[model samples]
Target: MLASKSIKMSKEQVSTFPNADELLDRMRKMSEDESLWKKSKTDSGVDIFEGKVSTKYRQFRGVGYVDQPLATMVSVVKDAEKRKQWNEQMMGNEVVEDISEHVKVIHSKFNGGAASNRDFCVFYTDHLSDTEYIDAQTSIIHEKCPVMKGFVRATCLISGTRMIAESPTRTKVFYLGQVDLGGMVPSFVANIVNMKQPLCIARMRDFAMKDAASSSSVPSSASTSPQEEKQNEEK
Candidate 1:
């Protein structure tokens, strides 16, 4: 089972990790720069793009529309406890340290089936607004969570989701992920896995839609007006 540990850190301690603002800026630029991305493929109405990054592994981006309110989608992604509900391979997930409302250090373990299990410790941060929400994360070293036995430590070069409200009941989602599953895995297998990373968007959409439908307290439509959605789309 996954659990969270609360650890209070001063501003100085938080500054030791990579700057969240800088990561957000880089993600925004990469997502917008058409020159950096090439058409990889499209699945289930989502367009996937492949691009080069600093690592040997390629980065992937998926753009699509989800039939759920922006807030519902955001909650689905941000809630660590509910990760296993949508993530098919997730074995465990926990917050190792809470840096702030927008930032935290997380440890996640995955089941690799016949192969050895994999895990990662990442620094996560998110920004939310009425029209758009951006959450970005990169792998980081944390003392509390070290490379554990029986599991390979994977590296998340960069991964996040960018969401824009399109209407009262729809959202435009952009998911970007670049990860190196460090091990003796064959390149062909790795490539195949990387190509399917974008499918996570669809899985998230399905899960969020179901959750929203089941919850009576949650509204089916967002409060954002059509004019507001249009203005956000323009920006």
Candidate 2:
């Protein structure tokens, strides 16, 4: 069985991040391979694939569904300041530069459990295409933000999110990322990446769904600005 599995997976699919369609296609093939290996080892709702992008770097592709509107999901994802609320390992996250309506540079630091904390300064630009799908990607070169001490800056070679509306109120999110976390990675760190990536998707879904529910429950008269909502939550 193992031999047959290996033979089956040898059929190559494009691993490079040339475009969104190619990325999505690669993810589909990865999902199939992962399913064949061991279903029990993977997350229930997320399809995860790992590959080597370079000698010391790895690429990850994750696809998951969120039961929330595309707009709601995108809004939550684009709000970098609020990410720590749901993202498990985000110790610090901030928008370093807002270049335009759809372009900005974000700095984020992550705790690696026992390992040294890792950080990345990324220039991100997001836009809704003609097909109504939201595309967001982090620039490979982000010199606007300074790297912090004690946190090794990661190289986000290719990292982005693609959101497509599967239904009026449901969105299919696809994530593709290739990062080089500086220094040697322990087994625990790799395991954390495998587990935490799926959990991140679950967290985003929960956050967006909860927000949608709360928004729907509020009376139109009580509708308030985001600042008002935040103040109320704090109070």
lDDT by residue (22-75, candidate 2, tens digit) is 444444444334433322234657766565323334556666899877877777
Model 1 over residues 1-235: C-alpha lDDT tens digits?
0111223555465447888888888887777788888897899778999885434577888888898889888888877666678897998778999989888898989998888999988888888989988988888767788889999987787888898899979998988887777778665666577778888888888888787767867655867888998999999
Q: Which regions in candidate 1 have their CA more than 4 angstroms from the true location?
A: 1-15, 52-55, 215-235
What is the C-alpha RMSD, rounded to one decimal, of candidate 2?
10.7
The root-mean-square deviation over C-alpha atoms between each candidate and the true structure, in angstroms, is 11.4, 10.7
- After superposing candidate 2, which stretches have Cα over 4 Å from the reference? 1-42, 52-55, 95-98, 130-144, 186-195, 219-235
Where is model 2 poorest over a 10-residue stretch in terms of lDDT?
1-10
Each prediction's number of clashing residue pairs = 0, 0
Per-residue lDDT for 12 in model 1? 61
Report the C-alpha displacement of residue 15, candidate 2, in angstroms.
28
By summed lDDT, the worst window of 10 consecutive residues in model 1 runs over: 1-10
TM-score of model 1 (CA atoms): 0.80
